[model samples]
Target: MTENEREIVRRITDVLEKMASGRKPSRIEYTETDAPDDSTLMELEAKVVELNNLYAESYRFILDLARGKLNGDPPPHNNFVTPFKQLQSELRHLTWQIEQIAAGDLDQMVYFSGDFSRAINQMIDDLREREELRQQLADSNHAKDKLFSIIAHDLRNPFNAIVGFSEMMVQMVNMASPADLKQFAEMIHTSAKQTYNLLLNLLEWSRVQTGRIDVKPMEGDLALLIRTNVNISSITAEPKQIQIYYDGGDSYPVTTDAAIFNTILRNLISNAIKYTPERGEIRISVDTNNRFYYISVHDTGMGMSEEDVQKLFRLDVIHTTNGTNQEKGTGLGLILCKEFVTMLGGDIYVESEKGKGSTFTFSIPK
Candidate 1:
């Protein structure tokens, strides 16, 4: 080799050694005066520089990916970067799935290979189970609170009235007129009746919560059931002169749980009588579709606001108001009605406007 050839070979060896030692190598420039052997060395130097440039590009891309920077310039489309491009695509898709999971979509799943896929899928399943348990806990707590409220306040109030009126009656028996004695007896009877009804509802609600009540559907006369409930409710309505009008024929057939149906009707009729003013009217009507029977109990009474109507039949909220004669309530009856209706394969709803009357409608499979 000539002196120029040796010099070119030495420079290329230095660059190669630096690159091998993990250091940035100095660039080798082409010269004007070169032998054939020097030209071959220069070509070898150009190949080395090209390889180093490609290495640097790949290194930067890998570093960015390691740092979780997904928006950086992508690596060149070569054999060296093919695996990295696939990894980046997977990471982008994983980011979207994580976002969806955070936004309450627990249906997301990762299908990547190995431990990462197993861990992520397990995490999603655990989150969904935890959310369902949380909702159930909330419902249970609401039910507990409602039960305590009724027992502490509603149950106690009627007992107090019963005790006080009976005591007054015993003390006034000798000196009081027949009319005054009759009034006291009536007051005591009303309080006792209220207590009885509250206890019945409390027992029913407890059974419902414990899943003890079973539905027994049998063919029965719907008109006769309505007449019985209305006749029973009239005793309470007579005092206020509020009339109940039901004109269904002698017999209308339905397949339903008779006890549940009776309870629902009794509650609706009693609620109407409680809310209706003196001389107001209550109308019971029934309509039928091919699949269901729609029973409507409409009352001319002081109605509710849109907001108050929305609060009905929810255990989380307690809504109650005094009747026309200052009768007290715990709002449990409506909740029981909702539960029983649902149990009987029916849905109940109400429509009311402020100052106008309310119509409560429930549907039963015919």
Candidate 2:
């Protein structure tokens, strides 16, 4: 029934009808037959069929791309190729750009000209800002965790000792000998003093954390600060027979916060006395250049290993160690000292040998 009407126009119309219904053409042997009278119509129909095949191939590549299959070389966009291959190339480039950003290269930018390029560039910028904020939050959380650990473990110990010793004196004073009474009282005094000092430093650290401490820098005498600390330290040093030495010229001034300078000196000297054996020595000295003042506290005491020195200033590490004569410390003093020194635009450092001694030094900008 179809042999009489198998003209080129009818054949192309049948092909379009099949494609329009989302169907494939049936396989059939086409025998040579009389061509259409309109030669130009047959040529146009042949080109249309070729274009249809071309578009189908591109659709396959595009379908894979839609599913995130960005690998492998694709056919080049040629004369027969429309915007599909161009899209494939763009997607492949976009895939690489995304990989670079995930690898921490936030500077990558897309240069394609369109809404997609602009959107991608904006997304990269947003990611960069968020990455910076994420880092700051991580640092703050780490500081908080370190402070909590010290409070929960180290601060509790000294307070417990003070309460226990004081309670013992109250309950046993009548039955205790005069010597036992004096020893128990001395123990209570030592524990209370240590606890009080730790509390003061902890309060100051809290102030720093809450952004309450405004740094007010002024010119002040570094020597006088050292002298004041030396006098205060001597009261505790004398009890252990530890000799304190001070070396600095009069009126050696620097631009700094007096309170912060005083805090650094007090903590350093206090640490020295805690670690020194009976009859050991501590020396405080000062040196300076045009732009900065350097203060040092050197001690003839039980020294530290390299690892211990490294851990001393880290809040995340287990840093607490018993001082000589079983003196208790919260490790907060050095942490506070470092924070204060840094606020005044200075850096504190420690030099020590395992069996020798430790010299804590700091340089403050003048």
- TM-score (all chains, Cα) for each model: 0.81, 0.73
Q: Please identify model 2 stretches exceeding 4 Å from their true place.
A: 1-93, 103-148
Assess candidate 2 and give its lDDT.
0.80
Model 2 C-alpha RMSD to native: 6.0
Q: What is the overall TM-score of model 1 with all chains considered together?
A: 0.81
Per-residue lDDT value at 161 in model 2: 79
- Checking candidate 1 for backbone clashes, the offending pairs are none
Residue 291, model 2, lDDT = 86
List, residue by residue over 1-366, the lDDT tens digit for candidate 1.
888777767766776777689764344454534555566666776676666656556767767888998766675654566688788888888888989999999999888877999998999999999999999999989999999999899889989988898888889889999999899888888888888988899899899999999999999988888888889888879999999999566777898998999899989888888888999999999888898888999999988999999999999998899898888898999999999999999999999977778999999998
List the candidate 1 regions with Cα displacement exceeding 4 Å: 1-52, 67-71, 76-82, 99-107, 247-252
lDDT of 2 by residue, 247-270 (tens): 778878677889888888899999
Using lDDT, give the best candidate's number: 1
- Candidate 1 Cα deviation (angstroms), residue 92: 3.5
Task: Supply the global lDDT for candidate 1.
Answer: 0.86
